[model samples]
Target: MASHRVMKIYTVSGCFPLIILLMSTMVIQSTQERTDSIFHYTYCAIHQNIQTDEEMGIADLLSSIAGDIQLRQLDLRSLFPAERFPIQIRFNLKNFDISSDAEYSIAIHEFGVIYEGSCALSGERIVVNDGNGSQRTSASLRPDDTGALFMNFIDIGISLTGQESIVGRSLVIHGNGQSDLEVKYNSTRLACCIIGESDGRSW
Candidate 1:
């Protein structure tokens, strides 16, 4: 009986270290898996109404689209020459799966400028050419109520400039509520509609 008891005590002591090591390894592996889920991207949308320069919980919204894309850093600069308050945006491509044929649209209520020009895709090639080709910026529809809807694609390289503002407004994209954004101004929040998103196949 004395020998058996001594053996049992030694066996439990030897297993304790192995069990702790296994648990530690599992914790590290779980943390790494969670880190991989985050993605990042950089984009600039026109804002209306200067209601408040407050930063909302937009980080979560940003993270949702950025999966595995890390937010390294951003270089924002004002568009020169016209200097009409053009904002150059930079972001990582995260959770949002981007395709070469995909296309997105920006809606402007008033006169604006798209410095880069047209957005086009030929075969597996994506091109952003000058404002001279058939792919020039254009105003597609004119709502009887809203007057007209102007849109254009952004060139990744070209510098875009114009008076784009949606400080207090909302825009619809891919039928997602993300297009709906409101800002408070003049003691009242207003809605400005702008920007649209479409699949790459159409591009």
Candidate 2:
């Protein structure tokens, strides 16, 4: 019994250092991961798109929590006028080639870009209406009656009432993992604007 006890003690003594070394390695690995995360935040600029509709300021929070990158303070005067395009072309959603005779506008929100279009096309147009007697009939994006589900296209339209509220109507946009968007309408004008926190992701 005494010999067995000595052997057990010997085994424990031999294994204790190994266990401590393993724990030290784990701590080192965790520290390295945190250091790498700090570096990424310090160097990489963050960007977000309106299609996602994610209203969280994760990018700015990351820079703050990481304590590596300096947060830039933008002047309120630098903000774009609501009447003009915040970014050149406004509400930078998916870059699309659309034409309309009516006014068109788009706004960038925390989640995504919301745009209203009421323009007419000459040949092969698609017409979208706001369902408030404001029929935006056009030759653009006129899906056939068969309703062929193109996984790469989406369309939304709203009335341009010179207000941010969508009381008149809204043509909500949804994508099917595809890479196309189309919204064309008639002589009705559309109002576009940008509404979101401009710290991390803007224009």
TM-score of 1: 0.19
Please report, in order, the local distance difference test score of every candidate based on alpha carbons: 0.26, 0.26
Residues 1-203, candidate 1, lDDT per residue (tens digit)? Answer: 11211222344777888876776687776765554332112233332222223476221121112111011111233323343222222222222213222223222223222222201100111133334564433122211222222333333322322223222222211111232232121121111222232121121
Which stretches in model 2 have alpha-carbon errors above 4 Å? 1-14, 17-21, 37-203
User: What shift in Å separates residue 121 of candidate 2 from its native position after superposition?
Assistant: 24
Alpha-carbon shift of residue 56 in model 1 (angstroms): 29
C-alpha RMSD by candidate, in order: 18.6, 20.6
Model 2, C-alpha of 75: deviation from truth (Å):
23
